[model samples]
Target: EDQVTQSPEALRLQEGESSSLNCSYTVSGLRGLFWYRQDPGKGPEFLFTLYSAGEEKEKERLKATLTKKESFLHITAPKPEDSATYLCAVQAIGSSNTGKLIFGQGTTLQVKP
Candidate 1:
């Protein structure tokens, strides 16, 4: 069975603190690894797409990387505005791209000013 799980259901960080969130996945075939940031009451915003191990993508203070078995989202110098839920998803090659995503519950981050 294909599945994804994220650690630390919630995180509290002081402004300027840096931390890393963990994402563990198991799938029959990894077609793509996706990372998204979701704010309250809104759909997830795409952040990165990693295809192979040792691959990474970054924007602003956020970085995402994928490996053979897992992925990670690292936040550097987080700010209050950065507070949001981080989600990780995977797409399998057998799927029909019908917008079905196996999502982790999400890691809620809170940065205090």
Candidate 2:
């Protein structure tokens, strides 16, 4: 079974403080890794996609990178507006045709101004 684990289940940051969130996983046949940001009571919003080892993507303060067995979401100098639950998910090769994402529990971030 493909499994994902995220560290530091929750984070409290002073505004302008920078940090990185980790997403580690194991899968049968790796296809892709994804990152999303979710606000309370809202669905996740797509952030990035990593397709291979050394592959990376970034948007604004969020940057995502993938290795053979794990991925990381690096947040630089976060603001109060950046506070949200960050989710990590994966798509295993040959797992299904339905485009389902196996997700991690997520790391909730709070940036206090």
Candidate 3:
């Protein structure tokens, strides 16, 4: 069965510390992988979309990369403002254009100043 899993469940980093969050997935056919950031009591914010192995996207302190079986979200010198829950999700070809997504459990990051 297709599934997604994220590691560490939670992370705590000192201000200016860098770290990486992991998301691993298995699916019959991958259409896209998406990353999102959610703060408490708010909807998730779109971060990146990876379509194939070796694809990457970046925004400020965050860089996302995709491989056959996994993806990574690398944070560089994160600040307290970067604290949030990071989510990874995947859409399978079998879902057609309905945009159904299978989401990982998420990794909550806390950056302390």
Candidate 4:
């Protein structure tokens, strides 16, 4: 079965702190891996999408990288505005051709100034 797992269910960081969030997944076949940021009571905001291993994308203080079995979100000097629940999801081209998506529980990040 395909599944996704995220580490450190919660994270606390000071105003200038930098850290990485891990998203590990297992799928029969990979279509793409996506990253999203969700604020309380709001829907997820798209961050990045990686198509294959060695692919990477960046936006502002966030950088996302992908590998064969996992992906990572690197936050550099995050600010209070960056605090949110980061979500990781994967799309698989299953035998049914439905392109099903599997999501991780997500990591809640808190940035204290």
Candidate 5:
């Protein structure tokens, strides 16, 4: 079955601490991998898209890298404002190009100030 799994379902980090979040997925025909940051009571905010293995993207303190079966979100020198539920999703081939996604359980991060 095609699915996505994220580890360390919750994390607590002190401000300025660095960490890495993981997303593992199995899909029949992968079209894209996506990352989003969700704050409480708010919709997910798009972070990155990875289309192939060895592909990587970065924004601010977040870096996303993809491999054949997994992807990683590396947080460098995180701040309290960066705390949020990070989500990973995959879109399979033949699906509509209309921003549809199959999401994994998110990883909730709390960065202490």
Candidate 6:
């Protein structure tokens, strides 16, 4: 089975603080890794896509990197507005015809001003 697990279910950061969260995954065959940011009561917004080991993507103060067995999301100098849930999902080979994603429970980040 393909599965994703995120650590530190929640985090609290002071404004301008930087940190990195982890996502561990197990799958029969890895196809893709996805990162998303979701605000309260809203749907997830796509952030990055990592297809292979050593691949990395960045947006604003966020950077996402992928490895064979895990992925990491790093936040730099975050602001209060950056508070949101960071989600990591994976697409596994032979899991879907349409390349659907299975998501982790998510890491909720709270940035204090």
How far off is residue 87 in model 3, in Å? Answer: 0.5
Per-candidate RMSD, Å: 1.4, 1.1, 1.1, 0.8, 1.7, 1.2
- Per-residue lDDT, model 3, residue 55, is 92
Assess candidate 2 and give its lDDT: 0.90
- CA lDDT, candidate 2, residue 78: 94
Q: Rate the local accuracy (lDDT) of all candidates.
A: 0.91, 0.90, 0.95, 0.95, 0.94, 0.92
**Candidate 1 residue-wise lDDT, 43-75, digit = tens:** 999999888889999999999988899999999
By descending TM-score, how would the candidates be arranged? Answer: 4, 3, 6, 2, 5, 1
Ranked by lDDT, the better of candidates 4 and 5 is: 4
Q: Mind giving the per-residue lDDT tens digits that candidate 3 earns over 10-100?
A: 9999999999999999998899999999999999899999999999999999999999999999999999999999999999887454778
Residues 1-113 of candidate 5 have per-residue lDDT tens digits of: 67899988999999999999999999877899999999999999999999999999999999999999999999999999999999999998765545568899999999999
lDDT, candidate 6, equals 0.92
* Clash count, candidate 5: 0
**How many residue pairs clash in model 3?**
0
**Candidate 2 ranges beyond 4 A from true positions:** 95-97
Which residues of candidate 6, in runs, are more than 4 Å off? 95-97
Q: TM per model?
A: 0.93, 0.95, 0.96, 0.97, 0.94, 0.95
- Please say which candidate is ahead in TM-score: 2 or 5: 2
lDDT of 3: 0.95
Off by over 4 Å in 1: 95-99
Better model by TM-score: candidate 2 vs candidate 4: 4
* lDDT per residue as tens, model 6, 71-101: 9999999999999999999988882536989
Ten-residue segment with the worst summed lDDT in candidate 3? Answer: 92-101
